[model samples]
Target: MMPRRLILAGAVALGAAAAFAAFQPSPVAAREAVVYKNPQCGCCKGWATYLQRNGYKVTVIDVEDIEGIKRRLQVPDNLHSCHTAMIDGYVVEGHVPVEAIDKLLTKRPNFTGIASPGMPSGSPGMDGPKEDNVVKAFGPGGIRVFGTY
Candidate 1:
C-alpha cells in the first residue's frame, strides 16, 4: 500500500510539472532594424534612438550618398526622406513613428514599404508634437494610408 501511494504522488508531481511548462509563455525573438542615413544627419540619429527605446535592435549606417541607397532600394521620389531603415524585410523611410511601425509589423501587409514622405516637424525623431502626422505605404498596389500619428 505504501509503495502504491508513493508512485501516485510522483505521477501527480510529474503531471503538475508538465502543466506548468505548457502554460509558460514562449520567449519572443528580438527584431533587428538597419537604418541608413546621411553621415551628417542629426534627425536620423534621433529616429534610430527612438527605435532602440522601443525594443528594436537598431544598426545605423551613415552614407555619403543617400540618394544612391534610395535608388538601389527603389524608394519612390515622392516618398524620399533623410533616412531609410530595413526591418523584418520592410523598408521604412523618413521620420516614421514607432506606433506606425508596430502596426506595419502586426498587419504584415503586402507592400514594398512605408514612408513618412518628408521630415515632418512633429515626427518621432523631429522636433515638435506628433499631431496630424500620417505615414503611407507604397507597393505594387500603389500608395495607401498606413497609419496616423
Candidate 2:
C-alpha cells in the first residue's frame, strides 16, 4: 500500500500540474481584413500597414471606384473616408486606429461598422500629430461614438 506521505506528495504534484495548466495562456486567433481603396491612394496603403502591424492579416484591393464600394457596403455618406476595410463582418472606414478596432471587436456591438470620417492627421496612417482621433459606429440605429485615439 502507498504510504500517507507518498499519497500527499502525489496529490500536491497533481495540484501543481493542474494549476500550471490552468494558468497557461491560450493561443489567439489571427484576424483577417480586406481593404478596398483607390488605386492611387498612398494613405490607404499606410492604413493597411498599420493593421498588419497590429496582428491583422490585411488584403488590400485597389479599385478604380472606391465610392461605389462604400455605397454598396451601405456606409453612410457622412462617414465617408479615403479607404474602407472589412474585418470579421465589420466595416472599418477612414484612418481608424488599432485601439478602436480592438474595442469594436471586443464589444461586438450591433452596428454595421465604424468610421473615422475624414482623414484626420495623426490617425493610424495619416501624417502629422495624432489628435482628436474620433471614430463613429453607424448601423440601423444611426451613428454614435465608437472610440477616440
Candidate 3:
C-alpha cells in the first residue's frame, strides 16, 4: 500500500502541474488589421510600419478627407488622431500601443474604439524619450484612461 505522505506529495505535484498547464501561453496568433490615414501624412505611414514590426498585418489606406471616414465609422471628434484602424470589430486611433490594441482585440470592448488624440511625442509611432505624451481611449460617449507612456 502507498504511504500517506507519498500520496499527499503526488497530489500536490499534480495540482501544481495542472495550474502551470492552465497558465500556459496561448498558441493562437493575433489577427490582421486595417488602418486609414490622410494621404499626405508621413507620420501615419511610420505608425503603420510600427504595427507591422510588432507582428500585426496592417493595411494602410490614405484618404483625401479623414472626416468622411470618421463619420462613416462614427468616430467621435475627441478621439480623433492622425490615423485610424479597425481590428476585430474595434477602432484604433492615432498612436495607441500594440499592447492596448491587443487588449482591445482580446476584451472586445462594446463601444466606438480607442484613440490617442493629437500627435503625442511618446506615442507608438511618435515614440521618443520625451515625457510630454498622453494617450486617451474614447468612444461616442466620453474618454477613458489609456496610458501615459
Candidate 4:
C-alpha cells in the first residue's frame, strides 16, 4: 500500500496538471486562402496544394479570365503569374514561398501585396532545380524588392 504522503502528493500533481491543461489556449485556426487559376494551368493547382500542405485552408476557383482577375487584384503587368490568391486582404501572386507568405501576414505593410512575379523554375509549385526566387511588394506607390529566397 502507498503511504498517505505519496498518495497526497500524487493527487496534488494530477490536480496541477489538470489545471494547467484547462488554462491552456486552444490552437489557432488555419489561414484561409482563395486561389484563382486558369482551368488548364497545372502549376497553379500545384501551388494551391503547396499552400494546403503548409496549413492554409485553400479554395481554388477555375476562371478562364485569369488576366482579368490579375488586373482586378491590381497585379501589375510585370507581376503577373499563372494564378492569383487573396489571403487576409492581400494579394499573393505566382509561386510565393510559405516563409514569405508568413512574413507578409505577420508584418502587414502598406502595399497592394507581394508577388514572385514570373513563375520562375523551382518555385514552390513549379518543378525544377531550386532557384533563387525574387519576391517583390507592389502598390500604387510602386514596387520594392521584398526579398530573395
User: Worst ten-residue run, lDDT, model 1?
Assistant: 125-134
What TM-score would you give candidate 4 relative to the actual structure?
0.83
For candidate 4, lDDT tens digit of each residue in 7-98? 99999999999999999986977999999999999999999999999999999999999999999899999988889999999999999998
Tens-digit lDDT string for candidate 1 (1-149): 57998999999999999999999985865689999999899989999999988889999999999999898887899999999999899999998888888888899999989999988887888997656777999988999888788
Q: After TM-score superposition, what is the CA distance of residue 88 in candidate 1 from its true location, in Å?
A: 0.5
Cα error, residue 54 of model 4, in Å, equals: 0.6
Which scores greater on lDDT, model 1 or model 3? 1
Residue 136, model 3, lDDT: 64
* Residue-level lDDT for 115 in candidate 3: 77
Off by over 4 Å in 3: 1-26
User: Scored by CA lDDT, what does every candidate get?
Assistant: 0.89, 0.93, 0.79, 0.93
* Per-residue lDDT of candidate 2, residues 54-90 (tens digit): 9999999999999999999999999999999999999
Q: What is the lDDT of candidate 2?
A: 0.93
- Any idea what lDDT model 1 has? 0.89
Give stretches of model 2 more than 4 Å off: 1-26
lDDT of 4 at 96: 92
For candidate 3, the TM-score is 0.73
Ranking by lDDT: 4, 2, 1, 3
lDDT agreement of model 3 with the native: 0.79
The model with the greater TM-score, 3 or 4, is: 4
Clashing pairs in 3: none
The model with the greatest TM-score is 4
Better of 3 and 4 by lDDT: 4
